[model samples]
Target: MHPSKVELRVLGTSVTLQEHIRKRAEQDLGIKLRFVVQDGGSVQRDGVMHPDRYELYDQWFHSIDCLWPTHALQPIELSRIRRWDEVNALPRTGRLSKAQPAGGAGCVPADRLFVQADGTLARKPSERISMLPLTHNADSFVYLPDSMPASLVEGEESWAWLLAPELAGRVALQADAAIGAIDAALAVEASGLMRFRDIGNLEIEEIDGLIGTLIEFKRRGHFAGFWSSFAEAAQLMIANKVVIQSIWSPATVELERAGLKFRLARPREGYRAWFGGIGISRLAHGRVLDAAYEYLNWWLEGWAGATMARQGFYISNPKQSRAQMSDAEWAYWYDGARASAELPGPTSKHLVPVGQVRDGGGYVARMSRIAVWDSVMDEHNYLVRRWTEFMRS
Candidate 1:
């Protein structure tokens, strides 16, 4: 490794900072970049336990809640970020401000985003923050159009379909406890298997009830498999091993690349939303620290955001991203207009055909209607234990 190279540990689900953007950042910033990609769990664990090993960590916002308490991250000076004002304004004008369950119960938690005098995190405004906001999107399952019964093809899609008996033995689920539990809870409620008081932060009893139902389904061979990574999820679809399952945007793009047909659902029960960002490790100093900040700014630059938008992601600053996109690309992606020409995926491969419209319409319309946020629940430890049992069953 080059002595000046900055080590960045990012989520596998991150499509924005892939090779092209990294290469561009390297050329433009005059810094050597090294990427260590992993699933969310490994990223979180390594980031918290071994901060000295990586200069930068890119992951979901919920990770701030998990990592901040441990002092694993450094306070990012707002003045240093090129588009700090635009980043701050995102939650104020965008989906983060919207209440969850869409008028049912619970408010979006108050912003716990600030830097403290001790170089730790705090909730109030300050000269610094714990993380730099990056790419975010809502998630839902996908299913093969041909796999559904004729009667269900034109009918409304629901999260309940994950647990529908007709799809039993042909369904898959995500293997992550936090995300998988939320998806299962939604399915349980939507399928009338059970209901939770608050699905976002499930109580002990609620977790037990949901996992119990899932275990029973698992025992009956209802699931084709469980996937731990986006690539695994895409492969399952490609192999036709599962008819319906939780899906990430990039996975759907991969499925399309394989010439497989899948529809990302606009579920009637609403979508699971997630927010992600990048944070510098507390261990970074001097030149390495400078490189980390440079990488953060480069992510907010328009080109990477445009790449992410190609595969159904929204950046904190859309203005910058929009500038890098063509008019037709902007219309087909952000404006919900039907594609006038065949559109490309994140890797610039043809995916969306002419006249095809994006599912869930535009960003504002889709984000405003979130059912739950991907979260580490209150009984997270217990949820993980029970979830492990369910998976084993």
Candidate 2:
């Protein structure tokens, strides 16, 4: 590897976000970035057991709980981050200037976020944190508005639609267990098939019950297929004529670009929220470590944030990102107002047409009504094994 190069292993869900920053960082910081994109599960395994292989991990907050116990990540010194104070102030101040909800399975559990004196992990805040919060957003499924039946179209959107008998054989899901299971659990509960005690942190029994239902659905040919990446998810909808499935924001943009019209469903039950950030590998040191710090700072420097904002993702420091964005972009993405003009996506492709309004409304309205946060449940090991079985079934 070149001395000026930094290797980063990031989840596929964030490929566009990283690409938005890669060139800028190389030009401004003089550091070459080599990105290894894979599913979150693979990233988690590599982050925990082979921390030395990558300089940084860009993944969901759940990865912190999975990796910190093994000391796979280094404590991020807040003082080194350019926007450290702002990052720390987000949860308190709320991204939209209101008090955000406290305590949900979707959030990083306080008990597992801090670094201890002996190089272990703790829950309490200190000078160092587990990771530098970056891009985050609420996620939900999407469907073709025209493909939906009149009854469904007239009714409120619900997660139960994923499992509705009317839509069987046209529905799909994410292949990754961590997020897929949660979406499936929501569908199951909404369908009145079963309910979880805590959807975010399912127990062993809940895991089994949910996977069992998924297996039954699969066996019954209730799904068109499963997707491992955003590109794959988009393809599933296009190639298979899938009317509905779990979708990422970028994928939705890609679908629209391909001439497929889709509606991002705002389920009455609430949105599945996720928070992602960058974590330094425990083995990163010296120049590589310095580069890592610079790279992290670059994300908060406003350019990357503005880019992600185009795709409906919220930056940790909206003020900085807003400064980099046009008023139209800010109003459309953050304020959820009708687009004043054609709006571009992360790739700078015009996706939102003039007068188009965001699906879930403003940042405050969406974030405040989160149904669940993407989480690594306590029964994660069991959940994965069962989820694998269902995928194979």
Candidate 3:
């Protein structure tokens, strides 16, 4: 019989928030916290959830309570990101401050706006965060590693580089495995660099499921390798199953904590980085939600950026966390450590930015190619169709 999982309804779209709560709840209550994740935003009558609404709902929590830990490693400051528009635009960036306030015609304050940059943001603060609508949220990016390092020297080569026949069944993708796998397949079809047979003998699973799957495969001596989230993938390495897992600088912190020995190797293609952030939930327990707000506030502090910098990831706000950091911390966060790979972001290199919060302490940089969860669902839907076709054929 399944134990009744606590459906503790709290608000926010930040996966870290959920993770924190789950970890805390389990430690305190001795019960597993099962999260029923909804998009972080207000209710929409659009007959569908609006992305902007979700972003706002997430930020609303930041206003009420600090949902994120002040000590968490947010590469950017919410306040600094909010006021980005007043300053010069980021290198190859776009803007997404388009929505009006709820039940009002005037534009939401600039502090609440979201922003997206192609590569990364400028190294310094430009203006006050009090002027923007919301902080910037970074989106996650994906990349493919090749054994033949020379095969990938260009960052813009496309997602096909991951699909060689030698890797067909052996390859594991992140969240977008179905489509990412297909993308790899299509890449192979187009490039004719490799030919793969059926995956009849391969083990496949979603990215989240990959962790357990990899563990299981390791126990059974069937492990190949994996890719996906930077944090968990690093943990996989700690477990010694991540022979060649996908990772980012944030994972480096976890690696250090776990005392794991690993290094980011030079890729045949250039390195790639994905941007992503948390959103507050409009539909949630106000108090618990307030705790989430507190967490976000904590993230905006200078110490948080220092933590992030020490961990190897870039914080959004370069200035707000200044007081919390020592000169040595700042040096380590920005210049002291080397990134795994200096690569372009995963978005189309032409998206806008949005999500300004906390007097410019942190922000979310929107994707150049904007995709809601629905788009991810759509890819899964197509994967189902392909699986159906494959079964029929």
For each candidate, the alpha-carbon lDDT, in order, equals 0.78, 0.80, 0.34
Per-residue lDDT of model 3, residues 53-112, tens digit only: 232232221221122222111223354243343332321123323341111111112212
Question: In TM-score terms, which candidate is top?
Answer: 2
lDDT tens digits, residues 272-369, model 1? 88777888888888877877887889888888789889888888888898899888889988888899988888766688888888888887667767
What's every prediction's RMSD, in angstroms? 2.9, 2.5, 14.8
- Of candidates 3 and 1, the better by lDDT: 1
Measured against the true structure, the TM-scores of the candidates, in listed sequence, are 0.92, 0.93, 0.42
List runs of model 1 lying over 4 Å from the truth: 1-17, 92-110, 116-124
TM-score for predicted model 2 compared with the true structure: 0.93
State the local distance difference test value for candidate 1: 0.78
Question: What does candidate 2's lDDT look like per residue over 1-393, in tens digits?
Answer: 464555444433454435656777678877777777767798899888888778888888777878888888888997898787666444433334436664345554344555667766555567777887777788899999898888898999999999988898999999889999989988999999997888988998888888888888888899998888888888988885699999888787778778887889899888888777888988888878888898889888888889888767887888888888889989999898999988887766688889988888988778776788888887789889999999888
